[model samples]
Target: MARNRILPIFVPHWGCPHQCVFCDQRTISGCHRPVTATDVTRLLTEALPLAGQGAEVAFYGGSFTAIPAEQQQELLDAVGPFLRTKAVGSVRVSTRPDTITPETLERLWRGGVRTVELGCQSMDDAVLKASGRGHGREVVAPAVALLRQYGFSVVLQMMTGLPAQTDESALKTAWALAALQPDGVRLYPTVVVRGTVLAERYADGSYRPQTLEEATALGAEILECFLRRAIPVLRIGLQPSEELAKSVVAGPYHPALGELVKSRVYRNRAQALLETVTPGSDTVLAVAPNRVSLMTGQKRCNINWLRQRYGLHSLRIVQEPMEDWEIRLQSSESLDKINR
Candidate 1:
């Protein structure tokens, strides 16, 4: 796996016609000023020296292809010098599913863009409509196919806890997206920002954002689905920013949201393994040293849950050199009956 260190340039809502109910692009991207070719050049000038060898120059925070052709070319052209000198590995752009066309893809490929991330926020049309995303469920597949045809690595971004969205809907979206065979995926649980329609809905009781617990539980399940299909989840939650934290009015906003989600995954795996253990018996869970915190969970949530659920008199999680997801039970008593 190639490690990515992105030099991100935010073109804040540059070509988006309608703002999604949960989005506040300016707040999310922390860039309120308009971006121009000159701006792109200056951004690269500062970022290139610090970027990793295969670092990507990412144009994010809006629909890139939906922007005017001239503007798009100007931004793409600005990165040409860096690409030519190998200062940057490749260019990446995020756009809406409906914005892509064969012509645009060819243009993107010609400009040295290697990755295209589509904002396929939902697979359910009702969820899309309620979230104010203009594109429907039908557009994502064809867009992904087109990107793949052009040899561009496809990454799909999906949202959870959106207006009128349920866990089943989110799961369906995950399976549908996985079936597309995208190179990567980004999972975002909706947060009601101060100025978006979602905030108003939350204020008026029309929408109820997921609590941290709810978000982590659902996010963990979604993460497991992608992992099972061998699709890398590039991002587990929105990037934490001062702007986002300040602007968020409600929802599952946590600085450690990604870690929380991972801990939940470990918790689930532990539960499955513990189901075979004798109840009311003490047990010790040995996992990799680096994964001790994950196995224990934040505030020992996993440990506490396992004890209560399995009726274990005492549950001990320790660190030992072990393979990833490899849980070893060490016990002298009848608790040793469980096997991985």
Candidate 2:
């Protein structure tokens, strides 16, 4: 299947009632203004020609279905022509789990929405309450089932490093979400934004956000859980934006957060292979050329790690054509044995 090219229209927290502790939607979305139907029409008009066929028009950064009904209809009405003409293949909206209902799904279906992404941030009720989500964990599964029942493709979004979240809790949330068997998932590691409750908490030492290392480590663990179940992880971190960069007060925010997590995956995989071999000074790892950096890690951290752990005088990563996630260990004896 072709990867989706999304034409995003940011609503920027227009309909959200709860002020989640970590949210500064304007900063996160980089949109401080409200969106109108006219704006939607203009965006689609400009984007459709460039979107190519089967591009999705996504209403992101807000509770789309929770907005005023008239406004929702007006926005949907704006995209009606594109859908009718097949200029756009489908429509998608992101909304809270509690906001989904039979009536809303029917309305969305009539408006040509084929995908509904729920911001089911955590499966722990305590985490939900601590974050000011205003919804219980109980609402998530039924919402997923209901959306599936209504023929909409489901994407579940979960977060790591929330106020009460631990590595164990985050993993549990992933397992729970996987059991729902959604078509896709998004993993957003929490970042503290300025002018939010999180910022105040960070300043007062009430909430401690995960460091980049911590986030990447936990993210890799969560990511592996999803991959093992064959669920596609559509996104690994928040989309980096200038506004978000300026608004961040503290926490694990990295432009290349996804790459870091994948790099950790490579490190772990290589470690497993190393465990099966005897320690040697001249050890080398042969990985796919494209993933050399991921295999070696940022600043050659993985290379340094393997060398120290194995007591090697030299540990080198070389380019070799290999299958996905493949890494081969090479040494005098090991290489010869494998070649034989």
Candidate 3:
């Protein structure tokens, strides 16, 4: 398989109509100056030569389509040469759902954008309102439908730990997002960045941030929503950056949060498989070699927990080629079972 890479151009808050309570665009993008079409061209020129053919140019950290049509085209047009030469795949941009329209989609399509990612933070109106997203759930379905109508690949982004967000509301958003059946989703457990309203709320105790444990537990369940529907989740938690680290005031922020959440999912599955095993029995789990660390967890945490939870005399993981979700029991005793 060709290794796919992302050549990102940070537009920052170029076209954002609102200062979302949780975002610090300058800090997150590390772009102190406004991004221009010239900047896009210069950045791409400097970067694309080393990028693989599978490299995808993505506009991150702002509403790309929400920007003026001429400006949006200018950025997209900058990618024209790379597309013509097959240096990279078509571009992808993240935008607010309400910004999506026939006019914008058509312009994007004409400019060679193949994927449209919507920041559909929540599907509940109250949660949306409390989060100050400036748009409601009503626009999401129509936006997704229009994207699909244009034959563009759709990716939706949702967040957890918003103001007034509840477990049920988050899950409902996930389930509702799954119904739209986008090509992929990005699940973010909110982090309170400094200099934002969320930060103020955190300081005042008006908003409580999720501990790493709490966030991971909830993140695992939310991830399962997409897993069950076979909708690919592109990310979990924020990608660690120096700026982000410096900006975080509080909340479930971790560098390897995705791995942590995946490990938690593994724990859940391991527990289920362990349930069928006899108490105090020696057992072995066979997983793909690449997944050893994840299944074993950081510092063998999963192994220790499983041993104690299942009352097993011994438990070990053996290398084997299998699906990521597959774990086969290789026990000398009668605990032979396989988790599908």
Candidate 4:
């Protein structure tokens, strides 16, 4: 199914029973007000026209199914008129993995929810426990199976740098998530927002968040795992907001983190291709117009790295209309192309 522009509705921290160590939903989401059905109606009424008729309204920042039955229906019922008139094509919601049930899926299917996002933070039970995620790793596959059985698109979320998580452990988590065959994946490295339990841990030297460099490096590998499986990675890192910026005390927080991760992935591919090159060879790399920056990297870091690592006498970048992540390497002697 084709994806339209998403119209997001943030209901921060609503009906969340467990306060995960790394979460401060209101601060992270930049939404402080209590949301009602009226708010959902009024906001979408004005935004849907600009978003296009095929847009899906996403309920984010909380467990939509775990809330009281009446409250959940109130929100879904508010979308009734829009669904009828085709102002919105469908509904999507994010919730904790353990909260999903066949009954809940049935209700959502009846209410026009076509997609469900589960916050499956880690696949290691120890990591989950350390981070205060109450559910075990076992719940994830069952939840995914149930969602697919109900004919809903499943999106699995994973995190890195949680307490007791290593780079090896993070990659293991990625591998576990990939085996489930999700419709898409989202990667978020842990962040320490102020006023959360994580903040208190950071103050006393009990926890360490991944550095920007660390997160980017690990993210490149994690992204590769999904890409190899032909799974689309819908997003990487947190969405930036002035409120989120002000609230974060620490962690691998960059506004353009997804770009950094993608760049590293391209750089890795180029590095592998360059390993067979003769020393002092002049070369030119061609990529899609929109991917030039990602291929070149910030401050032309990828270019500089290749020159140093491969002993290239001259390196140049030229843009061309090409497939995404396609990089063609032409040296003075040989024309070598790598495609993915």
Which prediction has the highest lDDT against the true structure?
Answer: 4
Between candidates 1 and 2, the one scoring higher on lDDT is 2
* Model 2 CA deviation exceeding 4 Å by range: 318-322, 332-340
Candidate 1 Cα RMSD after full superposition onto the native fold (Å):
2.7
Minimum summed lDDT over a 10-residue window in model 1 is located at 331-340
Once superposed on the true structure, which residue ranges of model 3 sit more than 4 Å away at CA?
1-3, 333-340
Per-residue lDDT tens digits for candidate 4, residues 1-340, read 4576888998888978899999988988888976899999999999987888778999999888888878889999999899999989999999998999888898899899999999998999999999898889999999999999999999999999999999999999999999999999999989899999999999999998899999999999999999999888999999999988998999999999999999999999998778888889888888899999999999999999989999999887778789988888776544444431
Shift of residue 39 alpha carbon in model 2, Å: 0.3
Q: lDDT tens string, model 1, 159-205?
A: 99999999999999999999999999999999888988888889999
lDDT per residue as tens, model 2, 1-340: 2357899999988889898998888889988899999999999898888879778889999999899889999999999988888888888999999999899999999998999999999999999999999999999999999999999999999999999888898999999999999899999999999999999999999999999999999999988898888898998999998888988888889999999998998888888878866666577889998999999898999989888887777777877788756888887557657669
TM-score for each prediction? 0.94, 0.94, 0.95, 0.96
RMSD of each: 2.7, 2.2, 2.9, 2.8
Q: Please report how far candidate 2 places residue 76 from its true position, in Å.
A: 1.2
Q: Residue 58 error for model 1, in Å?
A: 0.4
State candidate 1's TM-score: 0.94
Q: Write the per-residue lDDT of candidate 3 for residues 1-340, one digit (tens) a residue.
A: 1225888888888899988888888887788776887888798888887886757888988999889888888888888887888887788899999998888888998887888889999999998888888999999999999999999999999999889999889999999999999999999999999889989999999999888998899899988888898888889988889988988999999999999999888888888788899998888887888888888999999999999989999898877878876678777544344442
Ranking by TM-score: 4, 3, 1, 2
Query: In angstroms, how far off is 216's CA in candidate 4?
Result: 0.4
Q: Model 1 misses residue 130 by how many Å?
A: 0.7
On a 0 to 1 TM-score scale, where does candidate 3 land against the true structure? 0.95
How many steric clashes between backbone atoms does each model show?
0, 0, 0, 0
| lDDT for position 192 in model 3 | 92
lDDT accuracy of residue 162 in candidate 4: 96
